[model samples]
Target: MKAFDWQLQKNGYIPMSGQIVDASLVSAPKQRNTEVEKEAIKAGKTGREIWPNEPNKAAQKDMDARWTLKMGGKIRYRSDGTSLPQIALPVFGYKSHIAVDRRFGFIRESALTSAVQADGRMLPRLVTTGNTSSGVWADSAYRSQKNETGLALRMLVSRIHRRKPAGKPMPHNIVRANAAKSAIRAHVEHVFAHQKNRFGLFIRTIGIARAMAKLILANIAYNFDRLVFHQRA
Candidate 1:
């Protein structure tokens, strides 16, 4: 596949997506729920069936075909860099656009949205990827000078249209205003990590759009889970 060049505008966003499923619904032959794994070990049914195998037929097929649709991308680290791998599940897939508060792990504003791209769109998603209600932030992968010129122009137009009230400042000042809006909107990484670490869930699908949907659902579920747990405690 041909790779495309991307850039991160001073103001960009990173949209996130995920999925949630019942532990019993995944079809892996060696599937072992952590709860089941412990019980089976106690019953002397202990085997490698509980944990995932790299070469198992079920694992390989699921990994290739359904993982992304079911699970969604998970963050991982390698010798080279970090990767978002798939996690499998049943029923729902969620795609969310979040903007975070840079000074804290709070979400400023977010839209629970859906994606139309199989591999997903580069700019629309990234430019809106944050929990901030103000501006956006993203990496170089989301921005490009050539292919995304139209989108860039659109964003510029939108920014201009949303410019501050009259008797305020000039365009450059508004640019700086947008930049400042993004200043407190840089905490998405920690939010992503919290979602991953707390849920122990990640992407597991091969279909890109389905995977994106799965991701969105997970975030919604995570928030609800926290609310419920915190209330009881």
Candidate 2:
């Protein structure tokens, strides 16, 4: 699938415009663990090694999957304008980090890792200097001083959303900058939404290898569908 995408780029079919980076959680079935078992595992009495010893029980547990929490999109407001507690839902599975071309919304690069992995840590692998020379747009999750320095090293403009300091509202200039960056970064979400909604891009597979294969195929399929739509239009 990656080879095909690269061929398209090599043939000048897909433009290498600025790239937008983002990640989405692909939920896997929650691994069932009893309270006692959970405590045993935490205390090091039981470990992943037990799974290999019991194939039947191991089948119920996804050895490769990990748990992570995803934040609710909006903060609920009460009648008096007090914000309700933000809910973070437990999701077990993997994260799909993708770089999409800004011009055609094609998936240019991708990396899959456990859901618990930090999105920023995978940015260097998902993005490349060759394609991102123009710029790279991403949300706050991908922002950090280290990432800013890395971007500068690659000679790429950092359009990542700035993180406001703790306990203080963002300065007006930074807020406006984020708004402008979001206008361009939001296009990346369209590819993810199409895959999730139209193609049902969810991981039913157990291991990282299977999950990654599924996501890569889906990305290739999405690029083909996008190409067809553009040609038709």
Candidate 3:
């Protein structure tokens, strides 16, 4: 994938525009385990260690898959037109993180983790210096003093969206600014939408290593499709 990206640069498909970083959960079959077994898994014990007597059973169990609360699905409403609050649902599987170029919309970098991982921590790993623009865009979840500092250290401009002040109505200026940022940040969503809807991406594997390989292949396929589109244009 790195080689192909480099070749794209040589061929004038460089990611001159800034990059957008985000992650999405790829669903997998939920594991059925007892409380004790779940505790052991949470403690970082291997499947063989937890189920030492049942090698066949251990081989079938996916110890790496995890549970995470997916926030903000469809908004429901009451009969009177009042809207209900968004609910967070538990989703079990892996998380795929990708850095997409704003200009060409190629998946330049990707990482995979258990569904429980934090999206904020993965931001730095996905950013690359190859982009001509230094600006970075992401949702408020990626906003923090640490990330802001990190971006500054890397000489990258921080265009990450900010959250509203807690318990207070969002200031109009911030709401407007985030709205504009959303317009640009939204380009990355197309990549995820295409992969999930078109490639039917899901983790049917056992460990994070296998899951990572699966995500890498999906990203590569997405990039190839993106490249072809650019070529046709």
Candidate 4:
């Protein structure tokens, strides 16, 4: 349920179309050895460097395939903001995706798991857990989906008409409540923008492992700023 800005790139691991292929791989030759090592780890097999009949490229490819499939594919935006292909990377090397609240703010939830369009399943769960009485505010990402995977969304709609008392068709109260809730939640979106804009996080790095470590350092610094000076100021 950790939250952080992310970057996307094509042929990142191995360039798809470009001279350099990717930033990290292109930046230094030392990275070549690192890639070999990473491939070894990702494969879950031992390396031949220190043993016989140990794990090799074949083993790594097998393990990498499992992870690669789950990752889906490359995500790109057209000149007009339309998504070229629906591929997306798992944010922050996290197993499960992030848990963003109704305001698009970060929420720490364990139920959130990694999958295609994870928020589709997450939003409703959060709402249901919070109970539908207070109403939940959300963005287009949550509303754009046609199916309701999370129970949160259903509970919310039910809470609104619970009293129907008579046969009053639904009420506008739900709309009003969501509007108010959204106004406050919108700040969470800003939180994301602020982090990514300040840090060069919108682009993939030379290595996912190094990129992840840097991301952790960045978050630590960010939290420190808020705790030490921003909060007190």
Candidate 5:
């Protein structure tokens, strides 16, 4: 897969102008356990041993899956000016982190990890070493002093959105900068939407390895379709 993408760039099929980084949580089946079973597992007892009568029951649970909460959408206000309740969705699954070329949205690199993994931590792996002048755009979730410093060290322009501190309004300049960055970074979401809506990219497997393989295949399929579309254009 790496060879094919490298070949595409080498032949000018995929331009390495700049890149965008983002991640999406792919939901997996929720593994349910009783309070006693949960305590047993938390106490370091293997799932199989939780139910001594059923020695083979551990195989039924997806041991690799973990739970994480995704923040809800923006809150809408009522006509009377009251704010709606915001609810966070509980997701049990894994995350697919990706870096895409800015020119045509072709995915350049990808990584899969458990849902508990922070998106910022995967930035180094997702980003490919490319032209120093190229910029990398990402949302506020990827913003941090350490990450910004790392990008500086690599000579990649940090176009990451600035995160507003708690109880403080972001400066006008910072807000405008984020808005501009968002305009370009928004293209990355289209790739994810196409994968999910068009290809049903959700993972139905139980283990991390299987899920990773499925996502990698999905990415490759997306790139092929993107190439065809570019040719038609």
Candidate 6:
């Protein structure tokens, strides 16, 4: 991936239209363990330490991939016209943090983390200094004073979506502004959709290192596919 980024840099393929940053959960096989085992996993106990005698079970255990609640799967509705509440489903896996060039829709930068990691924290790492436009966009999850300050430090403009205050409705103007940002932010979803739908992205591996390796290859494959797409067009 570093080589590919260098290639894009040396060849002037990055058009400076800025980039969009977001992350997708790469679901993995759910591990079934006792409450004590779960607590030990959260407490940073290695699989070997947790299961000293059973080498086979210890090897199969995945301590690096954590669990997180993912909301907004399928929208359910009542028999009437109203929609039901969105349930938060518990997903066990890792996250693929990616920044895609706005002009070409190619994955420019990426990182892998446990599913429990916050999306907001990965913003700085996923951002690329190569995007000459100095403009960035993302969902409200990436919106924070620190991120705003960081962007300012780099002289990058932020089109990140704004968050509504707790117990308060969003103002009409801000709501419209966020909607406009979403229009541009929506392009990043294509990269993810293509990976999930066409590439069938999922993790069957038991450890973070292996799962990340799979994701890295998947990202490279996606770039090759994107290259083919532009060449044909």
lDDT of prediction 2 = 0.81
lDDT by residue (25-133, candidate 2, tens digit) is 8888887788766555445543455565776775556556678889988544555545668889988888889998787778888988888889998778877765634
lDDT of 1 by residue, 32-129 (tens): 23665446544544244544463353333221122124445533444343343557545333334454333323333333322211222333533332
Roughly what TM-score does model 5 have, to 2 decimal places?
A: 0.87
lDDT of 6 at 105: 81
At residue 74, candidate 2 shows an lDDT of 58
Candidate 1 runs further than 4 Å off: 1-60, 63-121, 126-134, 156-185, 204-210, 223-233
lDDT of 3 by residue, 86-203 (tens): 7888999999899998989998999998888899999899997779999999998899999999999999999999886655566789989998999999999998899999999889
lDDT of candidate 4 over 117-144, digit per residue (tens): 3444455444424321334444434553
Candidate scoring better on lDDT of 4 and 6: 6
lDDT of 1 at 29: 24
Q: Candidate 5 residues 79-107, lDDT tens each?
A: 55456678989998888899998887788
lDDT of 5 at 232: 90
RMSD of each: 16.9, 3.3, 3.0, 14.8, 3.3, 3.3
Best-to-worst order by lDDT is: 3, 6, 5, 2, 1, 4
User: Which stretches of candidate 4 lie above 4 Å from their native place?
Assistant: 1-118, 123-137, 143-172, 206-215
The deviation in Å at residue 181 for candidate 6 is 0.8
TM-score: model 2 vs. ground truth: 0.87
Q: Which 10 successive residues of model 4 have the least lDDT summed?
A: 18-27
The prediction achieving the highest TM-score against the true structure is 3
Which RMSD does model 4 reach against the true structure?
14.8
TM-scores of the candidates are: 0.34, 0.87, 0.94, 0.36, 0.87, 0.92
Clashing pairs in 5: none
